[model samples]
Target: MTPETSDNRTLPWFARPAARTWRCPPAPAAVRDFHASLPDYAPTPLIELPVIADELGVGRLFVKDESSRLGLPAFKALGVSWAVHRVLAERPESGDGAAPGPVTLVTATDGNHGRAVARTARRLGLRAHVFVAEGVHPRASAAIAAERAEVTLVAGSYDMAVRRAAEAAAAPGVVLVQDTAWPGYERIPGRIVEGYSTLCAEIDEQLAAADAGPPGLVAVPVGVGSLAQAVVTHCRSRAAGPSASALLSVEPRAASCVLDSLLHGEPVSVTTGETTMAGLNCGTPSSLAWPHLRDGLDAAVAVTDADSDRAAADLTALGLSPGPCGAASLAGVRAALGGEGADGRRATLGLGPDSTVVLLSTEGSEANPVRVTGT
Candidate 1:
């Protein structure tokens, strides 16, 4: 089939060639080494979308499938678990890294991050107290609880939940292992970004195997932008050229922090806009994640819930299990492929046949197995 194509009349804002300045400082050497040893930090897998790639006029489309990441079923497990483990290891004097003690490992979550922290705490014998918004998926809360963490569902938006988590983090015994940073809390967020670096290392190997080589266009979903930061920083530092043309950050139109920051050259917060992909409904990018996205990422796009739903269905059709939030990059990729796409319902984001496209299927349905269709 001769794939039809559309060009964007309004070009995406290009982020300058920002070099990554993240410091891999010596903080928790033992834990960092332990995280490195988990052997589980492999690149998962990357698959092709032959029909969609061809239909959209792209040379090849690849998805770094996170549906089965670490057998826990999402990429959040990578960062969360690593952070929780490191936190526990750093405070060894806190006794057996197991059992609920006075000290609580606290953080707010849209879903996946909490599960990762909770899972890591339970695995290593530590206590966890995860704060979440009331409307967060019951399954996500339950998953955290399963790890023996006390899950507190706060009322209001994700920002409210985060504020509450921050308050709790101030308790003398509570250590905040947050995915997003504010004020003095930056270590946990940095760990989240560092942990995410493992994903890129895996993608490199996966891309090499397919012979489609490295991707030219990579569409990564951005919540607080930590994941996008990790992917863009690693990819730009390692791969570039025709095979790596652009690093695209896709956000829910309602909460496009990365796009707004890239456009204004500053971290500006937005009101929490509604979206079915709750995990990506963040209004502000992580302070730690901001610099990387602004400097390393090439462009940003906002996708709608309808776009994400269609993407979810398409991935399911491909026999790939994905949640609404998980399949989001596909939604952006589809939009970029079509002309005047930023305005249409069925628009797409695509590139030439030789322009290998990579979509980061960042999360999985396990967080919220069934999606509530959103407008």
Candidate 2:
């Protein structure tokens, strides 16, 4: 379907085939190797959802449960912690063996990323400055502050806070560890993306141990596309895995920048109005992740706020109480397999009864407290 086919309704949805064949690349050895030394390092669970698979009429369903990652409620800790470590480790003064007094890690976040950054900073004996957009949930802000990070509330959208964070990081003794990248600021964000490869690696290991063949279709939640890109890279790099696994990219209907970027053949910003899936409510795709998404995604779908809520409830009923963004992968799967034009789209991607689907449950329901309904 074309980009013009959106109705923006109670469960507004859209899908289109990828323009190129998706291929994964090798995971970054440096970042993955370093994360192994961190005390909090451990593989999150890859939970089998037999009931959901039965409900969806698929062979099997699996969730990469990231609700408790490195003591944080979200998987953002994986990336943020690694990025902060990389930034500090590379500092010239860091090698001199003197105390790195009062170094500050800075970033803009809707919630989880900032909290993770703050927690990482505090753990590493550094200060943190987190810029959050207006309308960020109180729990998320409080969590960041609890980690001793200074939280600054920007008046406009998340993109605005990103700008402010960039300005602040320009100060001496401050380092930016953002997940999104623009021109001329790619290194740190690049490391952040690489840091996320740990999740995919863990998922692969868990699946192997369970003797579950690689997922035939992997549905990933997309915001700035960093996590999805890392997944694609790791999956592609594996020598013995589902190299043909179809990647289904999901995002909030209100902030479908990756979908829009795919449709437009370039990274185009969208208007990020309020959305229940705050983590997926990014108006712009990361410049560092755009090429990966463009070349490595098999299909794209956008889910409405109601879809997110319902999916969250469904997962909670299955004993996985996920946040809105975390549940979006299931919502996208529902849309792709059961919603409008599902049959044709499924046929196009070769999804069917024998297909195994995997969804990345990227967070728990801790940060977001609001409940939205389908009207």
Candidate 3:
């Protein structure tokens, strides 16, 4: 129950399709208002990555560096803050408003999301009760605690912690603010997904400033499928070339829920396996995110263990120290490009040099290296 010392995570927010923006227009008006009220929050820059471009033979490769976004080193804060904010704004009758006070926001985390929730809750004068599956990364756990959240490690897996969070949220007054959505509990997570559109909006503005347009492709890491859909929807919404943007949802080969879901056109749980990419180890896709992805995403791919580690190392080379799960988008790109035993996966996905690609280094490697080296 100790605090997470540093947690001000990042996110790819405000992605919309050409027709409209707002993933959940029906979402709490206050949530929409909060997004509309960000005067001080500027868009993150889209850094052109020569190294990645040259390797993939792409004309250009861009990175939306979440690590640098708001300096939280991960994209979790966007969802956490938005979700908590919505929950508090909804329960106006409660004393102390959105402040955590006696009631706490609860959720499970394999990595950044818990820390994000904690960070947001603390900032709003609220408390967070974070549940982590057994063996959650020590640094990730430390980060959550650093935010002054109560970190609870359950005996089972991330799913188990999620179950506990749901149960806790069911009680009166306490809120279960989570990123992954389940049945009848779609609004909060959907708001989190909506928050990611801001990332897309920023990328568009940055590209406009450079006198260029949107990228041809955007690779997204799929945790519960929210991020992938969020980014894809935003990038494609704009009027653009023939194939506006192609999304490649990357998952751990072992725990490839979105991949399996895409392949089957229905959600399914893959048995969990050992992988260093804890955040990307989700076994199922969010039903809320499923439809958007099924209709919009171009393809889905699972990355190998070597791909994950090599990507971590490669990101370090990119001057972006990314945690295993965070660097997964770049890792999958490298694999698809045949850079790391992925000669066919790239061609199979129809990727080539002419394409402009964007990757989100979702986290910083303050912990992944130590975990990887230990293994």
Candidate 4:
């Protein structure tokens, strides 16, 4: 595929820092404390990529690998498990703060989040009801069912499933644990964003242990922008550098809600339909996260299906079996660093030879099996 030229591009947004402090509302310390208490909780690897770093002409490239977080194939467990705990832990009949009741957790997903919610519900002796769009990845659907949750297939896209799940959550004892936020429904999605902060915290500690400073830039795959919010919150609040890290929000070209919203200066629904990167297939930015992302991010990049598919193969060669969604950040890096507007974007965003870059490899190769081989 030819490189996307600026004249014909629907990609890349270079942002100026907001006049206000670029911070999200603080997450509860209890979420992090709860995640730490889990037996399976462990920090995923922060792999240094000398080869890609050299090619990208950067000082260093570090990937926060999230393929195996809390025994799940993707990083969704960090948010899902923590949100589940926060919801249950607040209940009066939490059984001496040990056993939760026969509640049901409901949510919609392209794949990983639903499975994570289901697994988290099971761990707490609660039932789960997961909703997915009709065309979700087959393996993801099967995996959600494997967690013993009742899976309902919706007729349209991920957003439609989200609406359906919201409808289903009206039943008594059923709680909607969604990642995207809407009007009057910001609390749980806010908690979900908070849960994701654990990864950013772990990345900070790991970098410090290696005597490395904070990365100059962080490129994250944006679905509804929850993970990006976490990264921004951590980097802004505790950055060792004089300034916050330059944030690049990456999304599927077909479903560039964050990019579209930023351009319009408000939330706008994207109608390009789904792309291959299922997890990043969101059509609208989360209400809770749009403010942080709109002000704090340095740029936004949209990559094509081919771009992410190729990135998945390249990451696999580097010993990380990233699925298409996971590798979108890498693809964004390529597009941002090598395309026609590369020099302009770099200079505009403060990325130079002295810069260190971090990419969030969000999941393993579960969404695309044909292009992936080994673990």
Candidate 5:
């Protein structure tokens, strides 16, 4: 079906045939093992919201609460820690007897990813230089600085900040550890995406423990699509069988790069605007992630900031402290399963009253304060 568009945004929902031909190597078992080796490592909660399931008309709803992974308010630590560890471990040894100077990790962020990179650097006795876009909350930049990393405020959008970070990383002894990937810059981002598999692995075990069968739908919030890439890779792996879970990509309506790209059948850069879901306010899809998302995603939806705010409030009322980005899964799900032609859309995506759903609440309230505008 052709997607209806207005104001350069695709309408609330779009679905396509789930691709079975896209194959990927299983994420290494060592990724989870490495995370388990971390001092703060523990499986985050897989919270069941039966009330929400009843409301949304699904059998069961589980939210993978990544609010406090590794002591960070967001799940980004899983990827950043593993990626930094791999990069440092693979660094070539000094040829001469002289010792090497301290390595400085550099990257761009809207909020959480930069802090994760900075925290990794601090733990390794290295330096970090984080670049952030203009209008980033002072508190977000301050949080990165609290890690002892030097923070630079770029006078442009997140994409511009990414470019600036790349330029700085060109200098000797600096490494760019961005989660988003372009053509020649995919290896590290691939590792970052691999690191995110730890979250999915935990979800599998947790679902078993809860006696919940395989998920029928898995909803993820996309920034540059790294996390969604990881989710698609994990859910579409050979082990998930032919009846793999349907994947949904959610993004801020004003910055719905992945949704726009999926609708356009290509990687399309968007002109993003400010949104309460700041972490997902990305303009471009990661080149490494685009192909996986293109083939593996079963649906894509974009939510307004107001939609996310209400979802956040609802999650809070349900006793979960999800930030706007984290709460966006609910918004997307609501959009897809409610409103006009809901029955047809649900049928297209194979949703039913008995279908189990999993939402990746990728961050906590500490990352971004939720502002519910209604009484």
Candidate 6:
């Protein structure tokens, strides 16, 4: 199926009067400590883009580059490593100081998350089983396999892959470490979402070191809304200050489940299609993530593949190698800050000339490459 194109005059956007109140616990210090203990672990770069900021009419622009996070090409390692460690740590060890039996980590992914799960399994001497949808790229599947994981290709969408992975995880010694959550399967997914707080924590310190105050606006690309949930949790908390930092979510127009859900006032599944932004091609919002998103998001926007491609090209010209998923944040910012009725939209979003902005560039080109025009 082909992706949908947004109206050049106006992009799809939803806004609320005041963000609903949602109490989210701050990320524990242990999460950061655990991530720091990993091999090659370090905080990713928070690059300041003065040129882009001027173009976007914002005071400052920063992109938290997650391209080379912990030796992975994407930010999934932050969540996967912590969740896997927590799960394993909570397991009952036999008196012999060993697990009772062999354990296998299982999950479904469009790309980066699966590879992350496989890497964790390989590091811990456990097995990994990764299920991918039919549309997943060959390089993604191969990457998972390269990590010594047993890769299964599900003949459907990412949602179907998740179902198949869940079924497989029903067996003994197999744990489903999926990032998305459904009823009766909330615990591990919650842990996965909490694990993402490490990224937010890093962003805080990086921004502080640069002498930048809290961002006035933060854009995050959403896929099943896990990372968005983490962003909302960090940005909306009292400790982050009651600063009016509007959280914006970006999704592929063809797979905008989060936007659809927000419009409907409930979590609703949509029909997803192939897109260059493979990592954000989810058809449903995670059940566990929906509440926080519903309450915490200031706005949601959907961008077409063309929009993301252009944004990617622009970032590349500026010496930033962002994948389609990563560039989606910039696409969303343009949609929100430009176009018809943009003045009113900007006013509502509290965006102004001196507003600080941060775009979460969640992946690098190696995760999902796309040919951008003029690049």
Choose the strongest candidate by TM-score.
5
What local lDDT does model 3 show for residue 303? Answer: 76
Tens digit of per-residue lDDT, candidate 6, span 278-343: 899899999999999998898899998999999999999999999999999999999888867778
Model 4, range 1-375, lDDT digits (tens) per residue? 122366467455545544124554455667677789999998899998888888898988899898899999889999988877777768676557656446889999988899899988888777899998766766778889998999987777778899999999999889999999999999899888889988887888888887668787899999899998887777666543335678898998888898888877788988756577878888989998888887777778888889998988888998998988899999988888885677877765577786889999998886433321111
lDDT of 1 by residue, 244-270 (tens): 446778888777777877788789998
Instruction: Give candidate 6 misplaced runs (Cα > 4 Å).
Output: 1-10, 20-22, 94-98, 239-242, 370-375
Stretches of candidate 5 above 4 Å error? Answer: 4-10, 97-100, 239-242, 370-375
Clashes, model 1: 16
The lDDT leader among the candidates is 5
lDDT of each: 0.72, 0.82, 0.69, 0.82, 0.88, 0.87
- Give TM-scores for every candidate, taking all chains together and pairing residue i with residue i: 0.84, 0.92, 0.83, 0.92, 0.95, 0.94
Looking at model 6, residue 70 earns an lDDT score of: 80
Evaluate candidate 4 by giving its C-alpha RMSD to the native, one decimal: 4.1
Model 1 ranges with Cα > 4 A deviation: 1-36, 39-43, 92-103, 239-245, 341-351, 369-375
What is the Cα-based lDDT of residue 58 in candidate 2? 87
Candidate 5 structure quality by residue, lDDT tens digits, 70-185: 98999999999999889987887788845565789999998899999999999989999999877677888889999999999888888999999999999989999999999999
Q: Least accurate stretch of 10 residues (summed lDDT) in model 4?
A: 366-375
Q: Higher-lDDT candidate among 2 and 3?
A: 2
**What lDDT is obtained when candidate 5 is compared to the true structure?**
0.88
Candidate 6's TM-score: 0.94
Error of 4 at 78 (Å): 0.6
| Model 2 residue pairs with clashes | 24-236
**Which model is ahead, 1 or 3, in terms of TM-score?**
1
